[model samples]
Target: MKITVIGTGYVGLVAGACFADIGNEVWCVDVDQTKIDKLKQGIIPIYEKGLEPIVNKNFQEGRLHFSTNLLDGFDQSQFIFIAVGTPSNPDGSVDLKYVYAVAEEIAKNLKDYKLIINKSTVPVGTGKQLRDFIDQKIKERGINVDFDIVSNPEFLREGNAIEDFMNPDRVIIGTESIRAKEQMNELYSGLFKDAEPRIIFMDVRSAEVTKYASNSMLATKISFINEISNLCEKVDANVEMVRLGVGADKRIGYSFISPGIGYGGSCFPKDVKAIINTGNEYGYDMKLLKAVELINETQKAHLFDKIQNYFDNKKDGLKGKTIAIWGLAFKPETDDMRESPSQVIIRKLVEGGTKIKAHDPEAQNEAKRLFKDIETSIEYFDDNYECLKDCDALALLTEWNIYKQPNFQLIKKHLKNPIIFDGRNQYRPSEMKEMGFDYFSIGR
Candidate 1:
């Protein structure tokens, strides 16, 4: 099968590489010449675990190709995937200009029958809209060609995109055409060697809403747990214990209930807002999701407030204090900083004149780019322990693999004061107290 994935972003690159790894000839097309050049030279733009090696191997093996010209990909591929960015607009609506542009370009170049699959998270009815637009465009050009649009939203996690793609729990295909369904089944069947995938066939609108609804459900769980974590703190209870006790139930699993500062990434925040925007546009209000969004916003600063209240002094008292941050990215194993809570926390700390020393295994450079305006008050470090040197206390933000069981003795030795602020609740409270360090964790 010859597949073309447009836009070499996170979704585009990962999907293209994984498809090629499965023996399909794939072309990863992007308008940015520099990005395509870098991809051709084995330079990956994103820091997803296990992504670079597969991309390099597949590229070297002549299965994966990167190009700036969409014509190159469009002319030779049987299946075209629109993996471009559909970012949020100012009013929280989906800004789908990129997806529309790609669809229009495909319409203009529709020389024969092609199965157009949309892998980007989009609003409901978008597939129908694109189908109509393409039909009109092709008719205006006096070309009597046929193309079937299918909604195939991606559910790949950032850190585990490759694994999720290769072994997805289920794949959703949205098209009424039996031929289109068969085409999609054949393409995705390569992912499973000996077993059939759990492919859910549904209407186009349902498939589009599934992507947003899935993220919104996870967002609700995150906000619900954070809200409960706050109440646990007030009632002198531990959220970790509550989570363990509650998660034991068969119905409610402990998937997205980890109480942290908040959920932040490219997906959760954007999808929640986009769904709410979609509801409002149709004269419907998603009240629960609205509260979920609000709670997530409040939770982002929950740890910062704890750090400030420990001193119980005015902002002037924090003017000269230096704090060490263990993580800067939203989560671990990725360098994405879009809407990271570290941004809100560090911005507040800097506004109060607090200096910060931050360390993240992969996000330090991204942190540098994100916090460049306030770089004077912040220092970047490669070693997590080295980041704690001469700081007032250590504030652990993202729960990276290495930051789990750190050397508390070294932490105490490095910090000017034996204090720690753990947002992820990585350590036990009793253990921290026994270790002779003042430790603060979320809801425990």
Candidate 2:
């Protein structure tokens, strides 16, 4: 199958590479000439695990190609996937400019019957709107052609996008056309041959709603656990133990139960807001989701307050303090900093005139670009422990493995004070106390 994936962003690049790796001829279309040129030279823009090698192999084998010209991609492919970003607008609606632009371009260049798949997470009824827009445009041009618009939203998480794509738990196809369904199933059958990932079939609107609902559920679990963790701390209980007790029930299960600063990435924040906006448009309120959003916001701020309150009624005490941040990425294994709690925590500390020495196994350089304005305020370290040297205290913002079971002896020896604030609950409070280090964690 010849497939063209428009918008070579995180989702597009990973989908394109994986499709090509599975023997489909893929042409990745992006408007950015520089990005396409770099990709042509084996340069990948994003830092996703196992992506570069797969992309290189596919390109070398003539299975994958990169292009800046949409027409070239359109002319050579039977299936066109719009994998562009639909960022959240100020009103919480998904900004569909990029997706619409790609759809319009595909409409203009429709030479034959093609299967148009929407792989970007979009609002319900977007597929119908896109189909109408394309059909109307083609009619205006006096060209009678047929194309099937199918909703196939992606559920890949960052830092593990390749693995998720290669071994998805399920494949969803939302289309009314039987021909389109057959073609879609054929496209993915080879990928899930033996594992037999369940292929879910539904209406287009249901498929769109599924993506938002899935992320919203995950976000709700995070906020729910965080709320419980807060209560556990107040009542002198351990959230980890509570999580273990509840997760033992086969019905409850135990994923996304860790009490963290908050959930942040490209998906959850935007999708929750978008779904809330959708409810508002339909004259119904998503009260629980609204609370979930509020909880996440409060969780991000709580980390800041924890550090300030630890200083305990002392003004300007943090002014000259040097704090070491162990992780800067939103999570481990990816360099994405979008909506990262590290941003909020670091920004607050910097405002209080505290110097910061941050280190991540892979996100250091990305952090440099993110905090470009703070020239004299922050320093990046390649070695995680090196950041602890001469620092007043350490803040574990993201749970990177190197910082998990560290040489506590070295940390105690190097820091100006043996104090640590762990936002991720990566360390045990009782053990840190026994080690003679002042420790603060989310909920025990």
Steric overlap count per candidate: 0, 0
Off by over 4 Å in 1: 193-197, 313-316
lDDT to native, each model: 0.91, 0.91
Q: In candidate 2, list every pair of residues with a backbone clash.
A: none
Please give the TM-score that candidate 2 achieves against the real structure: 0.97
Give per-residue CA lDDT, model 1, range 53-149, as digits (tens).
Answer: 9999999999999998888868889999999998999899999999999988898899999999999999998999999999999999997998899
Residue 67 shift from truth in candidate 1, angstroms: 0.5
- Please give each candidate's TM-score: 0.98, 0.97
- Residue range 199-270, candidate 2, lDDT tens digits: 888899999999999999999999999999999989999999999998888887899889989999889999
Error of 2 at 65 (Å): 0.2
